[model samples]
Target chain A: MAFLARIYVTPRADVLDPQGNAVAHGLHSLGFGEVTEVRIGRYLEVRIGGSDRAAATEQVTAMCERLLANTVVEDFRFELDALASDR
Target chain B: MAFLARIYVTPRADVLDPQGNAVAHGLHSLGFGEVTEVRIGRYLEVRIGGSDRAAATEQVTAMCERLLANTVVEDFRFELDALASDR
Candidate 1:
């Protein structure tokens, strides 16, 4: 089967996010006082050809752990949708 | 009112994604042959204090247009959640 994975990799809440802080500061300077905090992360869409949903889940999880996310400081989650069956 | 905005910024389908291509190549080299393609983008969480939904939407739309997205090469979409009523 063909599957599509939408992955979100975000920094753990306990971690200090300088980028987010900087963005919030910039927004404040731009006169958006209502803007409080900003957190930035990564979004990925991965297309995979796999046997089934279970198999795809395992594969995507491995991908997230091995390459997609910095598991020490960041956390990752994903949703998978079946695209089509392989020919 | 308090609102949380989950924003997704992605490269347009027609845009050239060298980063995606490179990541796909890396995955293939790492033996994840089932991985076909990878498109990478940015995810942002913005917390805002506003008067109402209509006001928040207008504010966020301006943020996207002016600072959040490039608008030329990327497209952005966001979902807003009301956090709580102000004290």
Candidate 2:
């Protein structure tokens, strides 16, 4: 099996996003009148191989906890792609 | 127009990824001998509306520069989703 894993990391809700704030100010200057809030995050695309779906899932979940995510300030979640699916 | 933006924020190649390293060690502990390396990042999905494609693209790009991305340590890129496309 192969997988493309996307992880989302953000400051906790109570934490302010200075980058997002700066961008919001920039948007104000750029004439995007309808925009209100902006938040920033990250994405990762991973390819993993395994003999079976169960094995792949196990491997990926472990991968996330140990390497892909920081449990302190961020939360992690992912979805599996069908073996032959196109990106 | 609507967009699903996936931002990939990774340490520069010169920078070491401790979280990724820790996960690699964990995988080694879990008996998955085939694993080699791990890297982590974040993802974001956004929805935008504009009267025209050009306007939408302009707004989205501005959004990325002004709010959605941290240019200092991270690189940002995004793709547009057809307004009616399914997630």
Give the number of the best model, judged by TM-score: 1
- Cα lDDT listed for each candidate: 0.90, 0.59
Off by over 4 Å in 2: A82-87, B1-42, B45-58, B61-87
Q: TM-score of predicted model 1?
A: 0.94
Backbone N/Cα/C clashes per model: 0, 7
Please write out the lDDT profile of model 2 over residues A1-87, one tens digit for every residue: 355454455656566777766755666777666555555655544555554667767777776677665767656666656455332
Q: Ten consecutive residues with minimal summed lDDT in candidate 2 chain A?
A: A78-87
lDDT of 1 by residue, A1-87 (tens): 799999999989999889989988988888889998899999999999976899899988998898889999999999999886753
Candidate 1 ranges with C-alpha deviation above 4 Å:
A85-87, B85-87
Interface RMSD of each: 0.7, 4.0
lDDT of 2 by residue, B56-83 (tens): 6776777666765566655666665555
Give chain B TM-scores in order: 0.92, 0.67
What TM-score does each of the candidates earn?
A: 0.94, 0.54
Each model's TM-score for chain A is: 0.92, 0.73
